[model samples]
Target: MGDFVKKLKTLKTEVEAEVPNHPSIEMGDVICEHFAISKPEEKTVNNPTRASNKENITEKERNKRRKSEKEKALGVKKKQKKPCGFCGEKTNLHTKTTCPKNPNARRMPKPKVS
Candidate 1:
């Protein structure tokens, strides 16, 4: 246990010595020195007409934009149909379980051996 602890301490010191100055240490010190320096400037708008004009988008354009934005944000993609293994037909309608050309449809039980 003592040897393990000694090895761990030596490893920690070696790592600290290898990385004498890291960006994280400097960033932490910079952040501590100027905590509120990164705050965004507040803008006060006096003209209500200008603000309304900025938001004057058509209903159809707004709907189209919203739909496109939603599709992009949700990562919506068109599904590609895969060809059937048995029939070689490209379809998204039927699966292997409901495929008409499935070989297992007319399968019979194997004969029991003594």
Candidate 2:
């Protein structure tokens, strides 16, 4: 009887410690509750290649991921165009017309005769 009571107390403390003090509700859970009343059904794929494909992604998705990774490696961020060094105007790349501070904004000078 005494051993049983001690086991019960230890079990209760273990359960209490396992549970979080303040659990956060996940955004996915809220979205699923709003749109999908029931749990989403999971389908198992049989194809080994499809299952083991790069992060289980299609070829197109893999290509897009690779491109984005390459861009990141090259230190390029999407949707954030760099401002021109000559002018402070935002442009993807510096151009003669876009850069007001460019000295060669006008037409190139004619070649000098020898």
Candidate 3:
């Protein structure tokens, strides 16, 4: 038991020496205590680039971000009303998606042309 703990502690120290700022090596004392092993005194380093648990951005900025996200989600959306793509004539009846003139389009009852 003692030899295993000594090996585990040595292995941990070697790993810490290799990667001082590793996330897994952050809570050295907690890990040691959990495994019934004692660790030497070590300085805890706080990451400078880490974000705080607070909302710093403005409401307008947040709204703008949300608007852009919505726009991206609904990218290049076609207009409900547009000119006939197949027949190449502007009309109120249908667009390319619903145009009867389209060869590959499903059989649909086309409006009467008078």
Best by lDDT: 3
Clashes of each: 0, 0, 0
Candidate 1, residues 8-106: lDDT per residue as tens digits?
A: 999999999998685555775678678756534576655565333234577677555434444643442344767866677776544555467786644
Ten consecutive residues with minimal summed lDDT in candidate 3?
72-81
TM-scores, one per candidate: 0.23, 0.20, 0.22
Model 3 C-alpha lDDT per residue in residues 1-114, reported as the tens digit of each score = 999999999999999899859455558767887899886568587568745343466756754543444464354343344567787776656667667778777656346433
Expressed as tens digits, the lDDT of each residue in 16-112 for candidate 2 is: 9998787677888888779977554786655554434333566577656444455654554344676665677665545455454677665432232
Greater-lDDT candidate between 1 and 3: 3
- For model 1, what is the alpha-carbon lDDT of residue 28? 54
Ranking by TM-score: 1, 3, 2
Give candidate 2 regions above 4 Å deviation.
22-114
Backbone clash tally (model 2): 0
Error of 1 at 33 (Å): 23
| TM-score of model 3 vs. true structure | 0.22
